[model samples]
Target: MLHAFLAAAIPNPGPEAPPGLGDLTNTILAWIKWGCLVSGVAGLMICGGMMILGRRNRNQLAIEGVSSTVWVFGGLALVATAAGLVSVVV
Candidate 1:
């Protein structure tokens, strides 16, 4: 059948890092992940300060701070689940 023939034409070897670059790739990924964590924490702290400072008269700043908080959390969530998501897709 055409379906079987097509399937046989393609190979699925699963995901893999290049032979010599695995260690370097892993190290880079780890560094990126660490940076994400550090930035997320810093973002939260900055947002907190914004909210506190804007609570007095800068209502617009407070709103902006709250809005950005959601984005920061969303980014953190994505980073946290990236590995699992990649596995599921691959």
Candidate 2:
């Protein structure tokens, strides 16, 4: 019968699926951590290079570079704190 065929074709999902939002939250947090790490490293490298170049040229650009580096570090710290908060809350 059509009813029997349809029922047989549907696969049963036992314990394979996630129980709730925990798995999703952890996965998202992991992605955010990696993204922030990579970007932070790249930003630091670029700013460091700029700082070195500015110093060599004896120009005011070095100050700007330092400020930019500070901002990058601050942003990284904020992201890290946010991720930790999410883990604790969720």
Candidate 2 structure quality by residue, lDDT tens digits, 1-90 = 999999999986543435787789788879988999899999999888878989966667777878899889998998879846765665
Per-residue alpha-carbon lDDT of candidate 1 for residues 36-77, written as tens digits (9 for 90 to 100): 999999999999988998998898888888999999999999
What are the RMSDs of all candidates, in order?
Answer: 1.8, 10.8
lDDT of model 2, residue 42: 97
Best candidate per lDDT, number?
A: 1
User: Which prediction has the highest TM-score against the true structure?
Assistant: 1
TM-scores of the candidates in the order shown: 0.85, 0.63
TM-score for candidate 2, residues paired by index: 0.63
* Superposed model 2: Cα runs more than 4 Å off: 1-18, 83-90
Give lDDT for model 2.
0.83
